[model samples]
Target: MSRVTPTTSRSIGQHTHDYAYYRTVLANHALPAAFIDLDHFAMNLERLRQRAGNLPIRLVTKSVRSVEMIRRILAAGSFMQGLLCYSAGEAAWLASQGFDDIVVAYPSVEPTDIRAVATQLRYGRAITLMVDSIEQVMKISRIAQAEDVVIPLAIDLDMSSAFPFIHFGVHRSPIHDETTALILARKIAEQPGVALQGLMGYEGQIAGLMDDVPGEPVKSAVIRHLKKKSIVEVNARRQAVVDALRKDGHTLRFVNGGGTGSFESTRQDRSVTELAAGSGLYAPTLFDHYRAFKVLPAAGFALPVTRVPKAGVVTCSGGGYIASGPMGKNRLPLPWLPAGCRLLANEAAGEVQTPVQHALSTSPATGDPILFRHAKAGELCERFNELLLIQDGQIIDTVRTYRGEGKSFF
Candidate 1:
């Protein structure tokens, strides 16, 4: 694996000190507000490109949840090629905004969404749908035929490893072997209105799992071993599948793989044409444990201290913004900034109030702002309508999230 050099000049300690800066900028604004630091966001974008080397990046829209932010990343340059939308309806919505070269990363069973995508295809938009079964292919084929347009399709391959007693990845895509992939490709090729366009395989165990977690050294070591072996196996399987499809006379336009955590390793694979990433842009708390690269904390929210529960504890209003994943303490929002503050064990991150205990020399006063980082990136947008854009200690812009635009496609 190639070594990744740290790019940011500021350390975690420096970032904590910037709490004063955030307070100063948002002094006149309301509490329980979310913001993005453009300087850190730009730094992270550059680092993602560097890790990708020469390969193109497909921005994952689900991790951003903002059309304006997506447009900004695409306008950055040619390094970003297209979007990997999570929902078929969202893909059509982005298409209506004049963005092309989109691929729905998940399968859709909704007839209305299928018709919407077909309409975009008829209007000369480059949108591809994902399928792992022939049933989904036939559904899309019927819609394409009815609309009198040829829709593009991509195959989703399962890249997880099955050990004797352990399954080491996400449960997605039943098509694993090369034979299964070739059979599906042939089936799509025989269809009248749909054509094979791409292949997508996501190795979530290697890409999403953290290898440098703090407490469990033995568990972290085991996870690292599993990731190393999974990488080699997945690459070989992906290559074989691609070769089989080509031998069967199917020409695939693109092969997408990887995520924010696996960019360095995934880019080295010869079979993958493009890599998908987006969570790294926000640098949430869950992404901080990776050893390959260090990302800045670009996104966070501030809540107001409403009361002093005790000498060492301060209660803030409205914090319980937990992240989506397997249940654990890691999914809770982290009490960042003001350096040494911590969440109380008895009542950690409540819906109406959160009590924080600290050992700093100065105690938190009523009406003071306390900053925190969410466990995941775009999920923060679900709680707030808009994100205040901060740059160099000033609010430059306020942009709407998907929720703010009255759009929610789950």
Candidate 2:
């Protein structure tokens, strides 16, 4: 694990004042509540739009688990074209909500879920399924045939770099070469009740990897070099794949690529018709290390101090909401507001009680609120039922999370 130093500095007094504001506004609320600063969230959204330029952005639903929040983003502007859902169930639910142009970004193997999507397709809803294997296509085709509808499909291309003993990106999508993509296109063309609609290649190496890690200058340089090489190599390969598919008479509706971290680089590829972004809207802790762009911390949760375990140590009520990824300190939630407070290295964050050590000068009494930023975006919503929407130091509205709405697709 590489050490990450804060790229931007904030004064301790500033954090103190920010926490004071939150405490004052949510004085009546319960502990362990999540909040989103609408002002900061809007700023982050504008940053994403600027980085995307003229290219369309597909909102990633997994990064934002709230339907209300997704609606707010789509209503914000026409730049957001569609949704990249994480599951077939989520896509069907979104379609039922009158959301058109949804693409299930992951392959669905379950016959029930495929039948659900096929039902939506029979109703003339624009929902596309993602596939990287012939087995997946066969499954979808069987469901489509059963439902008596033509299902749309998108080929998920593996954009990871292949070295002698090193793989640079995530292990997703078995289709890596243009020949494989063309073969899949031909397969789809010949298969009954299925049509190729798009091509998706997520360059997670350039999009998710941090290139400006602190205390590891050599590692950072290597990451930057790899990213530069990946940009050129991925662009050439992706273009070739699109070209081959086009020559095979497959008219792709969209070529999706990029993420929040690699927005600028991914959009530069002429083959990618649009980019996908969602985590940037909330600007979680994992997005902090990107050097190309900086986003404001928009979403956070506040836990009430329940005990003064020892001098200079305050224990919060509940805070064991860790983000998903390789186990590391970076995956732990960060103590943000009331700065100078640090998580105890020995215990870290706990499920019931999280003991935080503060500077000797700042003494926080019991019942005071402690603000924290989750390592990821939508994962924070999973911990709380509702997110208290805040703007200008006041709670405006409360929206239900996916869990609160009685829907847990994962």
Candidate 3:
């Protein structure tokens, strides 16, 4: 894929939404259907390209579980080069879809999944497995050797920082320093069926945690400080591991780093060959609080009002699409369109029905469209079969998500 520099530098939330337009355009569509604003998606593509600078991005598949949408985004720009799939099985699935340069971002010890990746490798597909321990390396090597194929592997580097009381990043890989990384690398070299291809360091503290939140000044300020500190520590640890591995004569094909939130800092590391991001494309509510960049809200789902309980209140059928993480109010789906609807505190969003409070000034009759944005990206796709592609106030086309294709890997 050839890189095309986006001639831009700015942040935009993309669309000017109107509830009447959505209700009218999607009059005949289903009650609860997921949709993507094509114009906003295109603008987000430009925004991500600008954030990445010249570095190509390996698209993270968990944030975007739609094969059709992934194809569209990859075809949209050359800056998007490969897939950073979340599972061993997902890597095999993508390889079957003709996607190459894939690195399964998480390690798997499942023999069936490893053999699936080997099958793709036998077909000349590039599917690299992720390993952080000697056991994972041996498991993959045993499966690949049994299949009679030499599989490429990438080491998952733990980029978390240890503070006084708090451990900064997600507990992903056990390989925190150069010593553990070299230990894993030596194990990979000893295996005849698996070759070391690259290293991946995901700074989740800097990348996934929200720093510029509204209303909580003290928390946000503290988060910003920790993020700033974590960036320096992340770069140093990643650099040390890369330098030591290279000095030991290990040829790494790529050093993957960062996510949507850490693009600015992660791009500065010369040791990193590419960045990984996908949630920015969909622009879920979790990504809305970042100070540096604001991507457009590209995807959302709309629910049809079932009944009008009061003048300022209405109930919608089936909305309980909460996000994964620690249980909090932020995990709930955000009431989006009509500009005045609010989720009731007592019930919140429910499995069968959701009661919402609206402004008395605006009346919402029965059968009106009540739109909502998910707390996270791609998880919304798991709820719906297809996403209605919207552009210029019209439903252009309907595309299938990974769930729509009857393929769910997680």
Candidate 4:
């Protein structure tokens, strides 16, 4: 099932029909239900492949919570290798489900999750724990009976910025200095049973920012500048860190970097062997901000209009599917179909009955479907048990989410 690259900007018309199908399928279910359009989802997946050029993509499960969807996308190509999981519990769950190479992208503080991951190492599931400090190493080692029994690990270097007052990214990974990175990599190398496999540095500031968007010019300039600076600075530093670590006598199995927005740029960096991407598959709202690519809105959540506040105002139940990030206008969900709607300021998104102001007011009556795009994807999918798989504008089948499977590793 190789990804079929789109040759034009037009959407696969199946999405429109998929919308109708879900209206009927989730009719009995609660309002404000969220789901993915498999057709568009597939297209987005293929688009990533086209954009990736020759580099392999590691699916980020945190961006798409549906395990079935994850497996389905991986089935599309052998090119989609491994997963950049967010939690140790999720890593263990994904591993048990038969995914061998799972990288817990962020450093974990949960002793229970760490122990759960350690328990899976006995089954030959190769889980890579991310470390930036010796404390993290000590924490994982203390949970397990022996450090040697712990699964292999990778080092996460902070690639945000080099110069003070010119910060260009997210504040992550304490191993920012090449000297510190080398020392820590050496320490991990010395630890028993823990193999120092790779290094990961995510440039969220550039990869995640939506520069070159039509309206936000000033902000766009800053983003573009920061991105260019971050790439040059981070790439050099990351390579230096890798070089220094190797000089200290460490074997680098892999050096993972990049995100959905950074596939091309990250691939351009000779030091980064493989990059991770998950949000691009589903084309979450956050990805809409990227200047490099335009992924179709594959995943969307539908909220049923339950109230007619006014002739112009239609309200849907439980609109509270806000994305987790800096709180602002962008954190709120975007109005998708039946345009001309805006989220209420005080209550950007509501728990139930989210009022919308759209020109297509006549188009939607009580019980009519109004599609809402989450500012971020997957997080909304967690609220739903199953996603209606729509193909060629029809409901092909329904698949269970990780939540529907009764798995909540988060």
Error of 4 at 383 (Å): 1.7
Candidate 4 local lDDT, 278-337, one digit each (tens): 888777777776667777787777888887877777888777777788878877877786
| lDDT-superior candidate, 2 or 4 | 2
| Tens-digit per-residue lDDT, 1-410, candidate 2 | 11111122221111213778888988999887998887777777877887898998999999899988888888878888999999998899888888899999999988878888877777779999999989989988988887899999999999998765778889998899899998888899889989999999999999888888788799989889888988888888999999898887889999999999999988778889999999998888888877798778888999999999899999998899999999999999989878898899999999998999998787888998988999999999888789888876888889999988988887
Against the hidden true structure, what lDDT does model 4 obtain? Answer: 0.77
TM-score of each: 0.95, 0.95, 0.96, 0.91
lDDT of 2: 0.87
Q: Estimate every model's Cα lDDT from 0 to 1.
A: 0.88, 0.87, 0.89, 0.77
Tens-digit lDDT track of model 3 for 1-410: 22222324453544556788778887888788899987777777788888899999999999999887778778866789999998889889889999998999998898888899999999999999999999888888888888999999999999999999999889999999999999889889998899999999999999998888999889999999998998998899899999999998899999999999999999878899999999998899999998888877888998889999877899999999999999999999988888888999999999999999998876777888898999999899999999898877888888888889998886
Residue pairs in clash, model 1:
none
Worst 10 residues of 3 by lDDT: 1-10
367 Cα displacement, candidate 3 (Å) = 0.9
Kindly list the per-residue Cα lDDT of model 1 for residues 40-68, writing each as its tens digit: 88778888888898999999998899888
Candidate 1, RMSD to the unseen true structure: 3.8
Error of 3 at 124 (Å): 0.4
Error of 4 at 397 (Å): 2.0
Cα RMSD, each candidate: 3.8, 5.2, 2.3, 2.9
Those runs of model 3 whose alpha carbons end farther than 4 Å from true positions after fitting are 1-15
Candidates ranked by lDDT, best first?
A: 3, 1, 2, 4
Off by over 4 Å in 2: 1-17
lDDT of 2 at 152: 94
